[model samples]
Target: MRGVFLLLGLVGLCNASVLTVNDEIHMRSKRSSESEMTRIRNMSPSDRPNCQPGVTPPKIQVDTTERLSDLRNRFTAAGIHGYLVPSEDAHQSEYPSNYDLRREFISGMSGSAGRAVVLQNKAALWADGRYFLQAEDELDCHWILMKLGEEGVPTVTEWIEANLMDGQSFGVNTYLIKNVEWDEMSKDLAKKGITLKGVTPDLIDQIWTSGRPDQPNSPINALPLKYSGKSWQDKINNMHVAMAEKEADIMIVTGLDETAWLFNLRASDIDYNPFFLSYAIVNRAANTTILYIKSATSKLTASPTDAATTETVQQHLNTGASGSCSGRTGMCVTVKEYSNQQLQNDISSAVSTTTGYVWVSFGCSRAVYSSITAERVIQDNTPIALQKAQKNTVEQQGMRNSHIRDAVALIKFMAKLEKEVKEGKHWTEVKAAADLKKHRMAVKDNRGLSFSTIAGSGSNGAVIHYFPTNDTDKDITTSDMLLLDSGGQYLDGTTDVTRTFHFGTPTAYEKECYTRVLMGHVDFADVVIVGGTFGREIDSIARRPLWDVGLQYRHGTGHGIGMYLSVHEGPGRISLSHSSFISDEPLNEFQFFSDEPGYYEDGQFGIRLENIVMVKKATTKYQFPGTTFLTFETVTMVPYEPHLIVKELLSQQEVNWINAYHKTVQDTIGPLLADDALAASWLSARTKHMTLENETGSGNQQTAFLSLVAFAFVTHFIL
Candidate 1:
């Protein structure tokens, strides 16, 4: 078997014109024993992240005096009238490393989504509705807040054009901006005879020279074939086919997740994201592969010590060659230092030798796109993204299993929380969040959190992307609505689930809003679509219930979810806005997305129900030629809060759907909670069947009886 795989791997590299997929790579996962499960359940939480008080970033005001003066000096030296600062790294990552947080460092706006532009005299920040309140609180009086999506508010480009003169030049770090964004801005500015120059060294880095954090140099580890479900050799062969179809001689993988997925690797360079800062270049005709990283000589081990070494990673990649690809055996790789100079030199050599074009994603850095000849560059979405979005059979199963484990932890936390709140125990939002994290860390195969947990109480829940801090933490009381949006990154898959709870009685308005949101979520999950339907066309299905009441949320309805990778993947999303480039892509089978429909009242409370669902083929009575029907199969098994539901508002069909969904949750997660008596009782009560006639009754009246049954079972085991 080893020899057969070796031959197929060699064919992938040695003969790119006739590359073949290496299907001989074995993919399997080890099942956990009952003893292991019990041991993991009793594990300590002291070693986890959220269990302890987290360090907070200092409230350092954005110094317009020293920082702006220093940046303006650089602009003068670079011969530009203004400079643009984006909140993204060279990889266009959503959560960039501290070293690449130039926008936050310069503007003091730490929100993830925003753009900063600074001229000699004036500066401004552009942010969406989610961060309007946050941006106002963070940015100093020196900066103008340009609220995005508001009527009559100019866009970043329009604002730039309005500020600059015809003969002036505006500058940006080409290595930090997306290629498509750069193209659009350049063309728009050029019409007014304004120059948009590509600055080599970023101005913010120059200003932040004194106390800037160092770049990440974490360990780069291999993801086992059991978890990845595909060998890197097979993935590269698929890439070769994609390149051949595009008639490109070289393909550049710039996105961090793209590189990690292509190579079957994982790292912790970015917070909450299992990814490293890296780039890859594959020359098909030359049969050469090069991985660029900060420390090429560093040891490569399987994360958390799974017995993989540098040599194993090399073997898995079939990487072994001294210099040239003249007589390379398999997919030989050359590890090189990560720098723009080296990347440019290698791209020049590849373009000089081949007559074919160079394949690069439009999501790639503008600097990378500019390195190749304009006509020879094929700019589009990377094929790896589409491939990664569509999970394999192994990955799909892993997602299901991970969500079950996640549900066990969440149920335990909710049970304990409801008990404590009823007993008048004091709990802060931060403490409750930590308790949830502690429970999650005790689950088997758990790695870490997928993102920071959003634990908002009362009015804080109204803030869509709210994160509680020490200064802003509020007590989570029974009278308030608690919105918890959180996720975990397990070894097998990623899990993101959100549920709003009301320990006390909710008002009629609150119940109505929650039920409306629930209705939207159910509608979205139940809708069947044609094969080639775009997410934008059907996004209204999730918002119709809210729209009928003239209430809406500012954010998108759903986003693509990654498998043990980035929580936010790309190429497909469920959003109504046309501003997003990925919203138009067709949804495909095996693709996972968050079916989250929400409604937020600015001062009172917020209601959102989120479930990570997989797109699957739907059974239809009739089949159309050249088309397929699709529907959602929800993988998140956590039940909704019965206290906040208004049964009177639910239709018969909706009531039946909710009942069926709760039954599925109990059937799936009940066995896993056999040992945790408290969690088992909670799950049973939460999943109790509901009917329209039971509008005013408490659905969990049987909780006391279930708890007694669980206690008897535990006592029998003790005897």
Candidate 2:
């Protein structure tokens, strides 16, 4: 039956000639035919043109360099020496594509990852590997194009330190930086004898003179209770219990993602981010309320039984149920009926009745926007952020399973690419990226990509954080090095991984940079810091090796990783500075952070090693005395390219860490691959014995050396 449906669906799609609900139905129907579906699925995504080629959106184009000059003048007039320009949407979302193209408007750098620092005398645009070629072509040559992660590129903080003179004040649009990033910037600048300012500047939109189009509210279809695994009442009750424990009488959910998760509804207002504009409140006594535009007919009580009932019964039931669930004594209110004034009055009245705390969930936009003071909403949401970061056993298990499946898909895609490239077939970066996306889509229960895939080759890789466009397309020659950083989302977990491989022989410089980055990656994973805040002077651990060689990536060493939500979720991060956008907010417990360290040589090549690390508290052991420890679980499964690794550059301990990590990946993912995928030559080639032993020190050997040797031998062979 499924095969028949798929056949019909494919036939309909081929004839339809245009996309519509019918087309979607046809596509979905074809989803069941594994063999037949594979044919359509094999089409290259890069070839489909999801985004237009060579046609820059007006919002993403810069008319002239005068725009930068105007920004500088505005900053000087406002008594600010520098203004931090971040690419963001009107909603101030982390997803840059959905936001207004601010960076592009000012500097003409079109990569998704970029920041412009407009100083009185100089303007600089910083970007990563994916944008190296694109940014150069689009951005004004006068603007310093600093490759991210390089020493000279300077982080936003480092820029402030070097450029801000004594008594010079730097300003950042507070909304642009998250509370955590803002706090770090503030503290770091303060230490350098510079004052950070949060002055509102309208010059950005003034010069651009355009606003994002209004996205109409669309109908949302709620998932069934069974699919959601919980009822509305049950979820509300659990939230009430949590509020009681926090000593908060009311819990306000501000983050749209959190609201969507709690309500079991999806919206298309934003691409990639499935959230509707809504607000939710739950009281400690189990009273729940939500405010949202009525975009869809309520089907809250619909069940399988209803579908089986007679037509007449269904019609009668639907008619009667429509008006029954309005704003009763304790029901959620439609946003239209409950005006802002009335809602504010209700909140004020509720607060006056109790001396209780307020619990605000993550990314509370409405709550923050409505606040008269800076700290009101931020303070209330801190605890909730911490709570959300700590994953439950079920979530962790889901993550582990997700990574295994994701790794398999990635390995398969890599094999396909190797075959194509080795056969003298010319492939574009866009095509390679599309192939990966196709493989990800093939996985059952997989949603779309968690983020855009970064497919860069050769000199393109030198851009620390690159976003590919058609104009920047590069042909994948067999002799080129490739850096593919990508991830996907499953219903159960989110995955992010980066692998740098040499299509052929690599230069000595490339090998050295890859080794350095790998060394830093290994160093960070072995760190056992306990009770340390992300910005509390702990960033040096990952940068120590790079710093020794006078090199670094301009981007943060690590960012908080989300679970089935924002690619960059927070309340926890690993960065150089302690202060973030919002001050006095506590870090989330058990939140995951990406451990990525990289080095880039402009017009040459770029290298980065990234893996998702989940924090876990370790019980204090009194074995030695006064030792506190914490452990991080490695969740990414893709293997590093051993052929490009200069093993001699790695310390014995670093080599041990790599071998142990690979063994873990093997153990976790080996059994899950299909026979054909498992038998692939690449998989077999990966199973070789990792070189663990090396020449011992001729002059001197310490106890640490013996311990490192013992660890390498034990971990290498154990798996």
Candidate 3:
């Protein structure tokens, strides 16, 4: 059996190596770069420490057929008809580490995106385009592979509808699923006469003993009040008030961010999401109990003493003579010390024994717990999510200040790139990317990059969500198009921006494509539809021009932006498809969305124009109307190649928008730049004025006239 498994593993490796010459060249070039070494070194010290004791890599033991048989047996014994396995945790991280490896453990597929549904007789795994090849190769042939986000492929909900029998129950681990997701699933299944079950026992851990790692218990350290701009007591008091309004006996907070925000704390327990593994229960009357691993103190203790001391003293100190702290009177306890499982059991027992109702807040973990019984957990946008989104006065000001600081660094980087590369000084994509990060770090209070920096040159830029790796040996040449999508996290706020440019004079096709993409971007920004849905808005604005030319991008036009949290936030977004699983559907007015539209030519180059827009209310006589109003804040400071912009392709409106946007960038960022950068900004700002005919042509002869007509038509109808 062992020999057979080894042979299969070797076969897979051999198959992976059967690549084209281009692939070999790309792979070899990537292996030779020093940037790759820098990336490995840059990871958290624990991931690759210098003096850590070496541990053997976990052995991969494949029991192909037996594993499936065992799962089927468990389903029968537990009275569960089926199980749903999602790829992400509470935070939808595309590339999750070992901590969130449930999907991989069950199906043996390692695609960054995918989900699985296991039934007694069969199973299926669903993935999107990027993972089709990888998923097919890694998953068992017998397990069905469903292509996701495409026509003809049923969604997980649709599949459940078809397979679930009346009165049948499906199991899911509550800790792994979010509240919004569970609510949608439960409502859909209920309509089909099927019940969604939350399995108390984590079946995945039982079957896969070797894959699960121990949960890290680092102490929760306080984020500076200057950064968070709120005291822990205030946040907790607010939660208590929200709980009272909802009439919930207790609000169960499961998401790490919610816990961190409530406690005014931060941790490196999870990458990107600065949160520790913890849970909390806040009663309507303001009483509270915290469930957390005991081991966290060691890590939390290492944080700055001033911040830690502030939190510890606040937690234990009495707020006043009333003998209560803030609005609530509560106690904090460790999960291991308090025994969460036992506490939950007691709550269940009390509910059944008494006639009173049980009210709890729902998130991914809490939602799963709600699914376990017949009790209905009222689902709503978490108080923390709402409070966090409507930034306080200080937070809003912080965001504005952060963008200005970030813009200065970006302007300098862009100016230097053009200067150095134009003089025949060659630079690799990796080096350019590193330079951007270094520049961002130079800002005072800048923590790090909000996400990975994408610096793609030429054909590589066309991979819309392209993340450059060391193996990406592409060079920034004078003839190539370049796309740099990046952002930074500061003590003040988070930022994300993308700018595509030409190193030198671009081809006619490139000019046309860039202009069309820009047109789509501006159209979306200028839209003033009242009560418009994102699905309808994106289809007509971003996709129309591309559709007219038989061109389109595979990705969404926009996604919701976070304050200083996740870059791709939710409850608000602009996309063609309706995602029922996320809360706060039908994005409210004043919400932020990225107005990005692009065209990708598989082997040549990609063009994208992105700007963040906020929904706002338009004033009118005897009425108040809402519309998607955009502000080209220019969080990203970079120059578009004037020589590559086909002025003839742009309408008068588009030309005006472009000129105005650049002017705003210059005005906002000019004073912050150093001497050399200020000079470069002056030069770049003037480039926007250059025209195809060296004259401002009449609207009748220019494309801007056509755009004006369209804009007028849209405004007339919407207003």
- In terms of lDDT, the best-performing candidate is 1
Write one digit per residue (lDDT tens) for candidate 1, span 511-544.
Answer: 8899989988887787777776666556656666
Q: Looking at model 3, which ten-residue stretch has the lowest summed lDDT?
A: 12-21
Per-residue lDDT tens digits for candidate 2, residues 356-462, read 77655433333233432222332344333454456656667677778888888998888778777888888988998898899998986576787778887888787
For model 1, the local distance difference test gives 0.74
Output the lDDT of residue 353, model 1.
Answer: 89
Please give the lDDT score at residue 383 for candidate 3: 79
Once superposed on the true structure, which residue ranges of model 3 sit more than 4 Å away at CA? 1-83, 90-98, 104-112, 117-124, 128-145, 157-174, 178-219, 289-368, 371-376, 418-426, 470-473, 529-539, 586-591, 614-639, 675-687, 690-719
TM-scores of the models, in the order given: 0.85, 0.69, 0.72
Would you list the C-alpha lDDT of every candidate in the order shown?
Answer: 0.74, 0.58, 0.58
By TM-score, the best candidate is 1
Model 3 per-residue lDDT tens digits across residues 1-719? 32322221111100000010110100111121345434422322132222135733222222246666766678876778998777666433433446777788788766445677887766777665434434544565436666544443445655655666789998887766666566667887787689888875667766766648765554555566776788766787787777667665555565555666666665555554455665555554335444443343333224344332454423432232222234544444332222356446544543443222244433445433553342535556677766765556566567777877877787788878877888889887888989999999998877678777778799778655556666555889898999888888776777777778887888888888887787777666655454544332333466566666777665556666555555555544554333334343444554555677777786688777666555555443444444443322334444455666667766566677667767766666666655665455544564455444534644553454356435534543452
Residue 716 CA displacement from its true place in model 1, Å: 60
Model 1: lowest-lDDT 10 consecutive positions? 14-23
> With candidate 2 superimposed using the best TM-score fit, by how many Å does residue 17's alpha carbon deviate from the native?
40
> What is the full ranking by lDDT, best candidate first?
1, 3, 2
